[model samples]
Target: MKYLLSNLKIDINNKIYLKDPESSDLGKRIIEHSIQLIDDIGFDSFTFKKLGIIIGSNESSIYRYFESKHKLLLYLTSWYWAWLEYQLVFSTTNVTNSNEKLDKAIDILTRTIESDSTFAHIDEVTLSRVVINEYSKSYLTKEVDDENKDGYFSIYKRLVTRLHDMMIEVNPNYKFPHSLASTVLEGALHQHFLKNHFKSLTDCNQKVQPSDYFKHLVFNALDTKT
Candidate 1:
């Protein structure tokens, strides 16, 4: 767990923020409060005005760090994916088997998240619920093309590419490594959403973990017995 050192920083895209929130005290406060607010009220109802009251800062102060609420949402989602990439790297670096590495990666994506004590201001567990519920709002917007062009989605894509690369290493003839990698991620989020709101759509039972289903889906899709 050396990767959980106090100084760990996840790189978010510069285009999303007017100023790097992690670099200043007030900026960090904004991020922390934003996470709590978004989780409490949901992203669509969350606003800098409400956040300002909670953080004891005016809306203008929050605006200095983010252009708009949408940008803040993008920043948060981007931060989560980048942080997940870091976790993936740290966890898999010492593992030797390609298939085992892939399994580890899949489990990381599908399993419940725990707060990393490395970053004092970020509550990864709460941020994860926000991600499962609200991360889609970051990209399911009219501005997605412009946002994509600005490199807002690179960290997530890079994470998927890393897993896809490992899949190819495990099976050179695999035809849809990219598809399977992305599916495991999106599918996990969707399953969590279902478990929260529409229980009929998911089987979040005690014994059958989502990771188990995802592992089967991935290994079966790859035509490999694990």
Candidate 2:
């Protein structure tokens, strides 16, 4: 776990910040601490008071950066998306070939699951509940709707669109369009994470790894042409 956290921190220092170095650094630390807190206490138990205690800063000091808990969550979600965009762009932008692009996309997916500890402590069931709770909130609901927006949502849009276009190139006869694939992929992930705790009446292979299974599902589903 220690090793994983260390490796994940490699390129995170710079991107985690905005502009002002001090506040940026402080925000970064607060975020790092917050992630740990979230993993430890779950999002429900998370509060500015707890974060202030962990970061050695007063509640007022933390509030200076994020006006409210909701705002902080929004920024945290934005940061997660931004970080994902960075990883995807870093791994794929240099490649011109469509196939290589797909491979890089898969690589990013696998690496994130393997390396990041943020999701390690979260069970699928808990994650799903968190998603539902977020949807109940207005700002968070907007973030979900705009997950495909080109600029703020570029990383997400670019990845899905690129893979979708590549799927078309690989197999014109492929029945699933990128949009559908995106829906299935995300829905499956959400369900798997949130529903893992429940017992299944139907026999299923629970041993199959999530990351690798996703890679196979994506490539195989798109392999109709090539």
Candidate 3:
């Protein structure tokens, strides 16, 4: 699996970036530092100029890769989802039982992230933190409808569809597969946020993981034994 994943390339929507950040050293640096900068200062305070200072490049050079910080955020979040989709596909490909496949999918989606060494330039762990902290900013905007039409959210939607299909496989009679699949994905993020900030609002803690809660929720909803 590591060998297969070492050669993996996560494709993002072309419209999300002015240039592909994986194409050159400068471009990769833009992506690498941008993740760190965003995680450090957050999406609201992150800027190309600040990132340029960190990477020792002119702000305009960064602009050559991403038109704006918002677009960069889209690229980052898109990359994260695409990478996660690969993990999901690889992990569940050989599971013969439908319920087991769905169980693995939930684990992959809701579990805390660890750094992946395959993509050395981009830290998956830090990027996951960025996604948990700022993913909503990528789409919660007036331009989201237009961007959705342009396929910026395709990878994310496809991921939800994958989970939705798994839900149907587990329980063909289930009426709300799409809604439940989306809720598992989106709710995992919300739960992670609450676990970190509003501790009283979430049941997930040191002993209880978000994945545990979600797995229980999903199995019960499907009338399946965990």
Candidate 4:
């Protein structure tokens, strides 16, 4: 049986949280405020105390849901990946053309994020910035392997796998589906960074949509050369 994950609210993996933040208004506020705080202050300077002060709650109360800001970052990134997966499923559910489906997937994955009314608590615009700027740091730690063992990257892996499948259907003999999919994701994030810091090194935000550039790259890698 198939499941329609986007028809209803998407569930963030419970492993990423000490307690489910979706369970209460305070819990939801913790997530909502944390995103804003991290967006305003860099993650290195963010703390539960500061978050609590901003949210009008005790610092310890913040810990009731997240063990640390790192875990919270993990949760946010995980949530982004799961939500992206849902967008992929929802957008592709009706399309049958392999190339068109892959194009839509690339567009959804690479394009800028706008808020979705379906998830009112998540400001995807800020969250997308978090993913572009901070997502890599969530795993660039000594505990990365342990976190990986604990399934911290499962949602991200699943998103890569889903897109990789589409690439394989586009080119049955393609040998680097995993590499291609990961490159597309990492490449998109890097393009955003490049546009801000080192604009001349890349042509992503130039005259064309970044998604179009990415679709071009993905097809070229598969030797379809769109």
Point to the candidate with the largest lDDT: 3
Candidate 1 residue lDDT tens string, 111-163: 88876777889899999999999988889999899889989999989988998
Clashes of each: 0, 4, 0, 0
Q: How do all models score by TM-score?
A: 0.96, 0.62, 0.99, 0.94
TM-score sort, best first: 3, 1, 4, 2
lDDT of 3 by residue, 20-92 (tens): 9999999999999999998999999988889989999999999898889999999999999988999999999
Instruction: State model 3's lDDT.
Output: 0.93
Give stretches of model 2 more than 4 Å off: 1-22, 94-97, 110-112, 116-155, 172-176, 184-188, 191-207, 223-226
* CA shift of 130, model 3, Å: 0.5
Model 3 residue runs over 4 Å out of place are none
In model 3, the clashing pairs are none
Better of 1 and 2 by lDDT: 1
Q: Tell me how many residue pairs clash in candidate 1.
A: 0
Candidate 4 C-alpha lDDT tens digits along 1-226: 0245435665766777888998899998998888988988878899999999988999999888988899999999999988888889889988898888899999999988877766678788898887888888899999999999989999898999999999998998999999999988888888887776788888866566568789988998888853
Q: Would you list the C-alpha lDDT of every candidate in the order shown? A: 0.87, 0.53, 0.93, 0.86
Query: Candidate 2: minimum summed lDDT over ten consecutive residues — where?
Result: 12-21
Error of 4 at 180 (Å): 0.4
Candidate 1 lDDT score at position 77: 90
